[model samples]
Target: MNIKPLFDRVVVESVQSEEKTKSGFILPSSAQEKPQTARVVAVGPGGVVDGKDVTMEVKIGDVVLYAKYSGSEFKVDGKEFTILRQSDILAIVE
Candidate 1:
């Protein structure tokens, strides 16, 4: 399955969460926090959107940090993904 965003939208997948804490305490699945970081899966063409000339700052394969509870989540081929606007992406990880 191919996911292509439109008009400054971005598709990303959550990075894996830590199973153990730095103190060597193991965390269970229910205790794990949601991952704020994700890898870019696909990007939309930056055309005019919402009366603004949007230029895409993110590209495919970029790692990014987003709001804790942003975007819509879906699954494709048993893999999870999130779709959000470019503005929702906070920063790109170098």
Candidate 2:
């Protein structure tokens, strides 16, 4: 499905939580916390800042880390996604 965000909004697909810890300890789905990292799926062209177009620092396919409580959640085609402003993103992963 194609998704286009508007005015600085970004669509992200959250990375799935790990089923096991680094030490090999298994974790149930209910015991896992939602992952705060995600990949950028779609992005708005730009946002108006003092009437000028300000482009986003991130682009589609960029993996980024964000605050745990950031963004609003929704589903598209039965898949979950998050809509967050650029400011909510903390850092881009290499």
Candidate 3:
């Protein structure tokens, strides 16, 4: 299945979170935090949003950092995805 975001929304997939500490201690799933980094799978077309001229800065395949609890989550074809506004993205990983 393919995803296409509308307006300034973007679809991203989470990267795997670290399950172990740097000290070689393994962390349990209950101790894991929500992953804030994700890979852009699809992006919306840049255009007028909420009466403002919005432009998209990130494109598909870009790795980005977002707020810890931002965006909505969903699943497609057994894979998880998140849909968030462009502004929710904090930085693009170079």
Candidate 4:
């Protein structure tokens, strides 16, 4: 299935978090932190939003960082994804 966002909304899939720490200590799933990074799946067209002009800075396949508890999460075709406004995305990963 394909996802298409609208009105400055973006669809992103969460990147898998590392199971081991930098020190080589393995962490259990319950103890691992939720990943804040995600890969852009779909991007909305930039336009006026909330009485202001909004421009999308990220594109599909771009990796980005977002707020810890922002956006709405859902699943499609057994794959999990998050949909959020472009402003909700903090920074695009280089």
Candidate 5:
């Protein structure tokens, strides 16, 4: 299945979080923090939104940081994804 976002919305897949600490101590699944970073799966076309000219700055395959509690989560073909507005994305990782 494929996802195509609309109106400046973005679809992203969460990147796997590190399971080990800097000291090489392995952390349990329950102890691992939820990854704040995600890989862009789809991007909405830039258009007028909320009466403003919104431009999309992120593209597919880009890694980005986003607000922790934003967006709606769902699953497609057994994989999880999050859909959010472009404004919720903080920064694109180089």
Candidate 6:
């Protein structure tokens, strides 16, 4: 499905958490931790600030780091998605 964000909001697809440990020990899905990383899917044009428009620092396809509990979850085309404000994104990864 086609999705678009508005006014500094961003849509993201969560990166799945690893199913195994660094040592190659497999972990059950119930024991796995939620992922804090995500890929930007859609981004809003900008946010209003002091009557002026403040452009977002992130763009579509940017990988970003966010707080574990920062966004709201939803599903699109049977795939899970997250909606969050720009402030919730911690950093953009290279």
Q: Compared with the true structure, what per-residue lDDT tens digits does model 2 show for residues 5-74?
A: 9888889999887799999999998899999999999999886956877789999899999988989999
For all candidates in order, the CA lDDT equals 0.94, 0.91, 0.96, 0.92, 0.94, 0.89
Which has the greatest lDDT? 3
Residue 64 accuracy (lDDT) in model 3: 99
Per-residue lDDT for 1-94 in model 1, tens only?
7887888999999989889999999999899988999999999999899899999999999999999889999999999999999999999999
TM-score for all models, in order of appearance: 0.96, 0.89, 0.96, 0.92, 0.93, 0.89
The clash number for model 6 is 0
Candidate that beats the other on TM-score, 3 or 6, i.e. the better one: 3
Please give the range of 10 consecutive residues that has the lowest summed lDDT in model 3: 27-36
Q: Candidate 4 vs candidate 6: which has greater TM-score?
A: 4
Model 3: residues with Cα > 4 Å off, grouped in runs? none
Regions more than 4 Å wrong, model 4: none
Give the per-residue lDDT of model 3 (tens digit) for 19-78. 999999999989999999999999999799999999999999999999988999999999
TM-score of 3: 0.96
How does model 6 fare in lDDT?
A: 0.89
Badly placed stretches (over 4 Å) of model 2 are: 49-53
Of 2 and 3, which scores higher on TM-score? 3
* Tens digit per residue, CA lDDT, model 6, 4-87: 887888999987877889999999978888788999999988869568777899988999999889889999889999999888
Lowest lDDT block of 10, candidate 5: 27-36
The C-alpha RMSD in Å for every predicted model, in order, reads 0.7, 1.7, 0.8, 1.1, 1.0, 1.7
Cα lDDT, model 6, residue 57: 95
